[model samples]
Target: MISNGVSGNKYMDGPDQVVPSDTYISCVPGGHVKLRQTSRGLASEPPISVPGLLKRTAARYPDGPALVTKKADGKWHYTTYKQYQERVRTVAKGFLKLGLERYHSVCILGFNSEEWYLADLGVIHAGGYAAGIYTTNSAEACYHCLESSRANICAVQDKKQLEKILSVRSRLKHLKAIVQWEEPVDTSVPGVYSWAQLMEMGAAEPDTQLDDILKSISVNECCTLVYTSGTVGPPKAVMLSHDNLTWDAFVIGEQVGDVKPTVDKIITFLPLSHVAAQVVDIYTTLSNAVAVYFAKPDALKGSLVETLREVRPTRFLAVPRVWEKMYEKIMAVGAQNSGLKKNIALWAKDKGMKHHLARMNGQNGTTCGFKLARTLVFNKVHETLGLDKCSTFVTAAAPLSADIKKFFLSLDMPIMEAFGMSEASGAHTLSIYPRFRPESSGLILEGTETKFGGAVSPHGPGEIMMRGRHIFMGYLNDEAKTREAIDDEGWLHSGDVGRLDTNNLLYITGRIKELLITAGGENIAPVLIEQQVQAELIHIGYAVLIGDRRKFLSILITLKSKVNNDTGEPLDELDTETAKWVAGLGSKAKTVSEIVNTKDPAVHKAIEEAITRANKHAISNAQKIQKFAVLPKDFSNHTGELGPTLKIKRNVVYEKYKDIIEDLYKE
Candidate 1:
């Protein structure tokens, strides 16, 4: 049974119910399953404020590890819930002593760290709103968000960000204080405060005042102002309330089968500024059943293995790129193996592909022969990748390839493909565990309503729309944009092109705005064609379709990093003779064709076959890639061609390659 604390409700009891010992009742919908003995219960009611939430969580599980940071000496430093609360309170008191007031936004500009989370909570606890700016944001973008949010105080990681703030401080009238978390630098700017000094000041103040300030906060008040990645234009601040955040945490917890913070360790690597990582990773720590771990930014690859070995985390949430990199590594290893091992891997992959095809066609289960083949062959591959311990794997931000999904599931790691946006507070829908549908973004989450708008073809694809409690309050100070996004009926227009199947699973096809209407007036979604072609080949990084309202469709492709010969070599050496090398390679067209045809027949055949496949899926005028160009370098966030979340900036790419695109269309 599930108890509301105020009242006992039978709705909480089910096979999936998490039952924790020590009166820690897991409040998942559909009832109580036994949790681990070490798990402790926090408050039954959701806290109205961030500080209140921390207070109740700390009191319930004082000794449980709340935050874990890897030290420079490679040791994990664990901080208990009580100690974490004390730090937050101390910092909150310090901010009050500095004369911070209610509704004043405090900006946190840094990478993921324990201090980042602590400062965020401290600012909120001191009756101020928390605004997170991405570490990679440019000086102009940073200034825009800070000034728009009306931030009076800023907590920065290092001298670089401090300098940026210092450069623009004179223009920002509300900017009064600057808090530096790292070692002090030679900043000539006024009103700069070191974090150590602030802590000392907090220690000198009375604790009662800090407690009183926390009590004054309400759930309806805005807790955070997270700016969107600005893939389209200038970033917009998504105002999130305490209720909004807590509700997101609640739904995510329910979806993942009620995670216990104390027993389950989660590695935090994604930026804390993003809602997906913050609400899912940090907020889950406050549940007292999960312990959060941090890794060094510079040594991510090496630190991942070290941290995973030490922590053995039960759940992992990551973007598609991480998994894509892992897939590449696995393929590289397979290519290097010899003799019986290589033969066995080839046979297993062939069998796995067949199994995957059957599964996609709605087969109930794998054939007996395929099952035996997998058990004998692919199990080692899974164990070697350190994926044996992963209980719940989820991928978001971009569409996941169906092949990648199948390969992981064959290795006994069923990944849940989720769909979300910054406006939706991170999650819109997730594939249910043990019953996942590959190539689809699963069913809409409970308490969320979805609809379709604009003109739909006979096949039913259209603009995706959503309305839910998890939706953001509005884009901060952008009334026109906010009004345009959310309709009179309260539905948030997602601008994505997709359709729901008969089973009600959502299949995201492409971006509606990116759809091309041919000269013959037929609408074509280029992404569908691009995804099919790209998934079948390993060389393509990104494919952009041209010929919108033109004679025919063509494409421009950015080559994958593995295929780029210039990669990993010194820039000076490459730059000295790049033209000569490119000319030499171009002269050997016959040899290049032979290599492409022989080494990767699949890739060569895919390109030839994709033209036919894409033509069948489109109208006569909108069919096929009439011509194409392969770029030597891949698009990336650092190159300004892709956003932080890895979405391609079409305008940037188009403008940079306009001459090439124009040449492709010429007679």
Candidate 2:
């Protein structure tokens, strides 16, 4: 029997209880109900496979645009579906010629690029397993992933990545070849293959053999091994079958409304290694044959503006941090502007808020004043931010602050918050446009099932457990961990803490493992506080909750940048001014206080207000952030306090600031 998992739970019984119309909406046109009323029997047929889905999609849209990237000369290069397929076959043939047999793992290490996607498809097309390492990973971390995956070949982007690979080449017995995308000054390393040479070799081969190989590839074969963005320790390689990825693309596409490339364009910049970017940007784009544009890494802001102006993309995906940054930049611009421009911007924002509130209350059309406000004020704001043409703006990876969500919605850009994990092929729940809850992560997808672990209080929270066809096969070579995560019944235990509203909309609270239990038995989720407080604090980059097994919650904050003064001015000014600003605080605290209060009052007040706002969202015991200390620098993965994905390594942070935390507790 397919275990529904939740026993004796009235809420788990039927579609009416699990999915209400008020909470969920159809992802397809005409808003037809999509979710099943009852769970399908265990004996039901399996869904279509990933490779088969790709082949079908390719056949359907052979002439459609598949990928676009900026050329070295700055012009955008477009690759059609037919051309993309040809390149994949050529790369696959090259891989086989290089002696990379089926199931032999190949790793790709780089930032977001067209080549990254190409290499990924090539590996899978060649019947080999593809793995991706974070660009920020150190040589040691790189070696650990490569060794763990038993990757024999690595496709690297440039010289820096090449150096990381070269550093550990002696110890990696399985590593037989290195494929460098960019031209290298020294190709002296044995078995190092240039990308150009490999393509040339593949071009010389017959196309018939490549076609046969692609056809022979099966759906059950492992296509990708994505290592978890290690927030604490070494990364775990999550094995994803072709079927897993294709199912994810199909489901996500269905949920977001059928995307037509002939009418829609997508901007791609998030790291291809990340599941959100991979599934949403690469696989989804390929499935639809949508025109996907690659933005330059160094000049992202300028590149984004240029790309948006040229392509006028209708859809885009971004993490909450990027949206937050956009908000900050817009606010900063308003702060700097004067006269009519400033008044117009502020007026438009007010009208936008009114329109947003009315829309939230189910008003179908905008008021005349709101329309005028949009044309005069918000239009400029949207154009300035390159979101004026966007039809869909998706936010994942982290929970968005309610205010931020509302702000975007006010701008007429509905921010669809989604919830998923690396194990679930990137999506499980998605907020459908025009029928979305600003606070909830929307209803679970049609084919997915969710169960609560225990009796969460009537409106309180519990662990979110899910089971679906798109769920990953298993973690590579780690059965114990796999069993620990996905039980014998098949439910993948998501480590998040969240609650379901009466309407069954899921509202994520925080990570279960990150929740701190106090000596007084009060539990606190640091992320909830961090999100609120960080929204307020412009100078603070990260905030770690202290006081585990203690009286109350305290905090350790990392400042964005060190400064000699509290004023929002550079410290590199005249020595006299720097010394004068640094002398305000008493001797013992002077040095640290000067470093902590770098930004101006507006920023400082924003942070303090965020803390206050966060407090209102918590209970009495969790409300008090009794004491706090700010470090001189931000926490970063390169600095060992955070993982590559910016998740704070709690133990590492605690260890690094043990003295400060102890002092806070004592105080």
Candidate 3:
């Protein structure tokens, strides 16, 4: 039996319980009901609740380090599994004492931290759904999520986050209390509590009510709400049951491998509000009793490397942008080298690339040159990046370009790619090493089922459909959309175009919704074309394709520029790497305005040449870019041109640049 490795508990390997999802979420008549009632994969990995997983880990490894954090003294500290469980219970009791009703949401808005995890599980333990709002969200966006989730209590990390809620507190009709988990809270405000105060309240309350609620926790009910990044429209709350989270965590951990009780370590730096981070940093670690180190609040702002160097985690997962940023920094540093040092670096990279390509092609790549390269350069690069201990390197959330993948491979780092949506609880296909081909999303998770629909050929590209226990319950409170998402047969329509090769490796082509149709009735996937443009011109931050029943495709390009860390807005100044690249191209332009206003000949010529090179790789003449315009500013979360996950918001871009697009299409 695929037990959670804990025995003797009556809940362990117990029969599944079907809870009323309508209380917390609304689904089609048989959406979640059918999955819960199905016995196909349920017997493989038994439906274990989140609370049960926590309890099992605590009991199985009482002394294991569950959570690690840095203190004021700059020393790493840890909370043992036993302590973590107790603290979760305390936080749960506190929520109960604060009048959190059953199925109500305890929405959390903050960076990943020990308190973040505590409050998350605590809310679920108190019989409430734990919803997370993106840290980059505006007060209005926060208000929408809070109101939609019907949150009873909202947790913020610092004063800034708390201020967002405070600005719209009166509008949140269902919100009863606010807890500032990091900074001090002004308790004078009614219903405002500090982290310490929340814990104290929980400690004072009897465990009778909390314990009773925990006993009634069913695996079939929604416990977490993953809000989509809302690239298309208003964010839809994807309701995930205990089974969805726990089963995914267990199966994903098993697939990635190397996860063990207390031995492995992983740094939590990605936004936990995203499903990928939630599964990898929180649930996956809990499932395997792996130690989780919390990155600093400024982890995204260059400090992530410092934390990584110190933590030296055993496994690492990063979004495509993060990996790309690292690549840029490495490239910048390598440019500073000269003479024999540069020669050695180049030689090592050549050897590394050859070795990686050979291995990827199913050959023994471990030759003398590879060994020498590892000793001379690759090993040092790994040590500096603190990935020396990392066995599994994963990239997800967005598509990674082939150029960036090969760049990392040349440094002896093979980054695996996983593909899925929030609707599937993080990942459906994971690319593990030896089987991980560039741009391929590897194989589907063992228990999950995937098929291509509407394809002309059996293995041809089509809409990717999946069905399994890992599928989410439904979009909360939208029966129509839920029914639209999950068909009568219970298969979730991904709306993503993909195909499975003979080797069963899934390759994602593009989003069916994001496709651009020409007036000539030709369909073009913008992402691949956009990626090519960006790959050819590393200085381009974003390339948005615009053509929907238009004559031909045109693109809006943005130069790589600085961004306001506080606001997530792109700044006018060019980023350092972009500046260097421009200087290398014989251009004196330093800012985006300089290049756009001056139309610097060197910069313009370089971009045109790059686009020409990219177009040559297009399958057809209709797919090539016919015109382009450079935007004054880069796309950013603040400007609403990009989503929280850094994926381009195509509609927002098109609307914002309508005038320029019209000008480009003019006869």
What is candidate 3's lDDT per residue for 1-667, written digit by digit as tens? 1112211123323214544332222442112332433445532766778888898999999999999989999898999999999999999999988889877899999988999999999998887889999998999989989998889999999888999999999988999999998766788988889999999999999988887777666777678999987765789888888888888888887888766679999999888899999988899999999999988877766788988889899899998888988887788789899999999999999998888888878896495588989999988998899898888889989899878888898898988988888888998989877777887876788888888787552322588998877788778778777777877667788888888987778998888888888999898989889999988887788898888899888888999898888766889999988998889999998899999998888988888898999999999989998888899899877788877667777788888888988989889
TM-scores, all models, native as reference: 0.81, 0.84, 0.93
- Per-candidate Cα lDDT values, in order, are 0.68, 0.69, 0.84
Residue-wise lDDT of candidate 1 within 1-667, one digit each (tens)?
A: 3222322122223111222223212121111111111222221333334565677778888888888987878678899889999998888888877767766788999877888888888887776778888777787888987888878888899998888888888888788788888886554557888888778988899988766655555554456778887767888887775655766666677767756657777788877788888787777566444788786664233356555556667788878767766675676566578999887766776676667556656776775467766677766665665555667788887777776777665555667888878777788888765446778887666667788886543223577888765676666656577767777566778888788887667888777777788788777777667766666554455787787878888887654532223222111112212223223444322223333334334333445565566566554545667776654356766667776656678888888888878877888
C-alpha lDDT (0 to 100) for residue 238 of candidate 1 = 78
**Model 1: CA > 4 A from native:** 1-48, 187-189, 299-310, 346-379, 454-461, 562-621
Q: Which of the predicted structures, 1 or 2, would earn the higher lDDT when compared with the native?
A: 2
Instruction: Give the range of the ten consecutive residues with the poorest summed lDDT in model 1.
Output: 28-37
Cα lDDT of candidate 1 equals 0.68
Off by over 4 Å in 2: 1-51, 207-212, 299-310, 337-343, 455-461, 502-504, 562-593, 597-617
- Count clashing residue pairs per candidate: 16, 4, 0
User: What is the lDDT ranking, best to worst?
Assistant: 3, 2, 1
Q: What is candidate 1's CA lDDT for residue 612?
A: 61
